[model samples]
Target: MIKELLEAKETDSFDELCVRLGNFLGIGKAVPPKVLLRAIDDPPFADNLIVCRNTPGFLQSLFDDPKTAQYDGDAGKKKEDGKSNTELIAKAATAFLKWGKAGFSTVDEATLERRENACLACPNLSEPKNKLQKLVAVKLDKERVGRRTGDKTCKICGCNVARKIKLPGESCPDSHPAIEGMTRWNEPQRVAAAVAE
Candidate 1:
């Protein structure tokens, strides 16, 4: 029975699922693995076991751009190590899992509804609304257009580049010119114009 239940859920490795099921059933309280396994196999308890054992996921993906968020008052500057992102996501995922876990007990139907509501209400768990979703959405929309931007190298040095760069852009140094017209489209155009020598 445990075997079949394990097969049915298929969420993680069998060992991890077994640990989760054990944890759910209060196994450390003298519950033997075989006994717990048999109990889970019982057709009657299949749904219960599946619900208890499933791992909950994060509520929403993040807004990934570093630029706009730089000036946004809330959330402040994203840190260098990306710890801010991990911490924010960890909090949301933990709360969401907690909300789901509390649902399994005799916690009434209203309680479960409350968990769902609370998860939805959580700001971090909330769907990336407005500006947040726009970041990922625009990138995905570009991908769906079936063209690769091939934004891969420095036009000047022919070296692979992390970002678009030009000496005239104030991005180069303090004394560099402010390249107002330079855009991704200008990349090849400028390269062509320069290389004609």
Candidate 2:
């Protein structure tokens, strides 16, 4: 099914492809970029599948001018020193919390609703079949504070979209610059007074 979707050629844009995959997954919405990339990065899907052989380049072409080809490539490749994704999510969580401690609050109701709607429309909002169980069970606790692993998690940050989207400074981590605007956030600030206006 995935192969057919990729080869269909009717799904011209990344969002369109995501919608197709999401529909296939019964998600009825677009999947996050990270989730889509993970599909291309994993072994059975990309390494052995004939249709996904050139998925990386194919995804790259979806963007008019991608900021970094790295985004369209495999996501499972180890970074230098082989830091696990759990460690990476933890680090990002810490940074976000620190920003919170610096007096940031959740976004206004309108913004929160808009962002949440966007997340609800994302396929990555749901858990993946090949989810990183260990990490999902442990490190993602902060992000999943009010949600479960099988629920909505941002494939990029592994954060629950419900919580993250409500935050005043949260934003989508999608690599394609245009699609990254699912939500808006205030710049980093040290005082509450300087938060979103």
Candidate 3:
């Protein structure tokens, strides 16, 4: 679908592109033309669309539903994780630097198991369906972290669950969906202590 849209973008006028995108998203006329046009040029919007294409009716729910239009991709930003893609990237980079400075050490076995268990039960742990997601997973696979049977990518932070759980500096991005007031993995003590200072 993205390939087709990119091809169409070459020859289609702005209005034509808007119609094409609207039809593709199954939003019909719910989203305004200006919003649709913005979506066409929005990199994050395209990335989210591609990543979520496998989800049944997700695009329609995001683009067609009037209630979600304001917060979803219509504004060229989807804050599903309450963090932008750039922020997520920055967080990952910081984690990597911390891990490197700590001699590439991993968490204790118990901590790894706990984190892995949380991620295994998380709704955000998803299979890498798109090239971008698969690439990240492949890169992280080299870490050779002990992986469980159902290990997959965490959609919020774009990390491979199996590898991410082993990093001491890493923490869950959101609270557990079913567990009120509990983060999937509590913030690392080092980070929490720093924040308290």
Cα RMSD for candidate 3? Answer: 13.2
In the range 75-127, model 1's lDDT, one tens digit per residue, is 23232233453443343233224323333334334433333332223222322
Ten contiguous residues with the weakest lDDT in model 1:
167-176
Judged by lDDT, which candidate is best? Answer: 3
Task: Give the range of the ten consecutive residues with the poorest summed lDDT in model 3.
Answer: 94-103
Report model 3's TM-score to 2 decimal places: 0.40
lDDT of 2 by residue, 1-197 (tens): 34325342421455555554444343446645554444433312221122222344433333222322344434333421355544434332332233323222466666655565556555556553332212222234334423323345667655545545554554565433243323223222234342221
lDDT of each: 0.29, 0.40, 0.50
Task: Name the best candidate (by TM-score).
Answer: 3
Better of 1 and 2 by lDDT: 2
Task: Judging by lDDT, tell me the better candidate of 1 and 3.
Answer: 3
For 1-197, candidate 3 gives per-residue lDDT tens digits of 33324345233444555554454444553335434433433323443443344453666443454433554443534443455544533432332233233323579988877787677677887887554444324243333335671337788866656656765655687775666655776543234554222
Residue 58 error for model 2, in Å?
A: 42
Model 2 residue runs over 4 Å out of place are 1-97, 100-104, 128-150, 175-197
Clashes of 3: 0
